[model samples]
Target: MNRLKNCGVAVALLLLSGLTLQAQDSTALNQSEKTIKKYKPFDANLQLRSLYIWRGFKVSDAPISDVDLHYKSKDGSFQAGFWGGASLNGNYKEFDYYVSYTKKGFTVSVWDINNFSDFPNANLFNYNNGSTSHFIDAGIAYKFDFKLPLTLSWNTIVAGRDTYVKANGKRANAYSNYVQVDQVLWQDEENSSLHVFVGGGFAFGREKNFYGDHPNIVNSGLTYNKDLVLFKYHLPVAATAMFSPEHKTGTLQLVANIF
Candidate 1:
């Protein structure tokens, strides 16, 4: 617990330092408000999300259950969550935790993918190889609330480290880029809406999976959203399919977010 606490403090300090650096750069360039001010998330809110998805449409056994903790504040966003699952005959397991921040329209995330379990379930394989290294990705997603209800999300990965697989051990350095376009299916302006997105990603440096091996990734998804005025809550449920050229067959995931 002490170690995790220290790491959290370090992350906070790093974020503060980065903000300071960006502010200095903006000052030096005499950047205008129009340039600096973009996609500001002004309201403060806390959201809790739960996800349950089964692989291959199997239901008699165990399924993946994830609980996410999210917070958006000060035009900045932070999220951290632990992922795992349970079977009717299985025990316990732990994998990765997500820590991320978004300032303006840009976002960065750190993933500590830990694989410290002794499960013999090959079908329930999680590629986290228990390495203590961290992965960091920085990208930007812009939404244009224009005539066609358009959103353009483009993210060029700045850097990544410590992605591990049990078979080949740990790949300490990795880089990738992702792009997704989101279209509004329906919306009521301020209260509620639904959206759909399709995007793909590619990794160029190193890989083991022969198919998605070239750093290629494709994703398509549909989402359903609704809001309750009395409860001040918003619900978004989505289904996503990610196809990597490296792996056989695609991985499907269902996610639900409650705010």
Candidate 2:
């Protein structure tokens, strides 16, 4: 009887230990699930445009496409994303990655832009000091929810191939920059109604691209956006009328969001 009682006590102890371990495992699993739920929001989009144009420069004559995928923290304080674009006709291609942090109405972002198609060498890892296909852009933006919604943004090339010779005969990183201000004309949150935006860009860079060398209003535009429902799916369409007074040109673009 003593031996049998000892065996029974040992078995009970083993069972209790097993239950404690199971409870620990359950708690760990619950914590993991909570972590995943905290950062589970994801979004993706694709934009199709008839032509690839920026700030009045025609990039491609064929169809242009932009695809983006992003994940955000549950509190919306952090985000990371991939954005890629390519021309359907030819060699124009771009791949970019960005990470951002937001607080209140302000945001700061770091982006890596790779113009792989424009690289002379086919090697993707080439980061030569003199010439490189990768550029880093740093940006900050602020939105005011005052009586009239207004947004101000600034972006500058902080690294990579953005270089130019100054008047002092020194080669230095261009640090090309652009600033813009936008006003939201209208928006309806309940109905997902139309959106109207008006904005302008001032180039602080000498690059011959979007923000040209001239110190003028390089980009000014009015955009209208609305959704079209087809088969119970919502499709967004945007129309933009952009003009560059410094370049003395205007462009009209239609964008369709397929997914």
Instruction: Report the Cα RMSD per candidate.
Output: 19.2, 9.8
Candidate 1: RMSD over Cα atoms?
19.2
- Candidate 2 TM-score versus the reference: 0.73
The global C-alpha lDDT for each of the candidates, from Candidate 1 onward, is 0.49, 0.76
Reference-based TM-score of each model? 0.47, 0.73
**How would you encode candidate 2's per-residue C-alpha lDDT over 1-259 as one tens digit per residue?**
9999999999999999999999999999999999877655899999999877764565666788999999988798999999989988767888889999999999999998886776756455655535778878899999998755788888887887776667998767767676778776776653333333333334354534335656667777787777878899988887777777767777878889999
TM-score (C-alpha, index-matched) for candidate 1: 0.47
Candidate 2: residue pairs that collide: none
Expressed as tens digits, the lDDT of each residue in 137-187 for candidate 1 is: 455666565654777766543432334344466344445556678888777
Residue 125 shift from truth in candidate 2, angstroms: 2.8
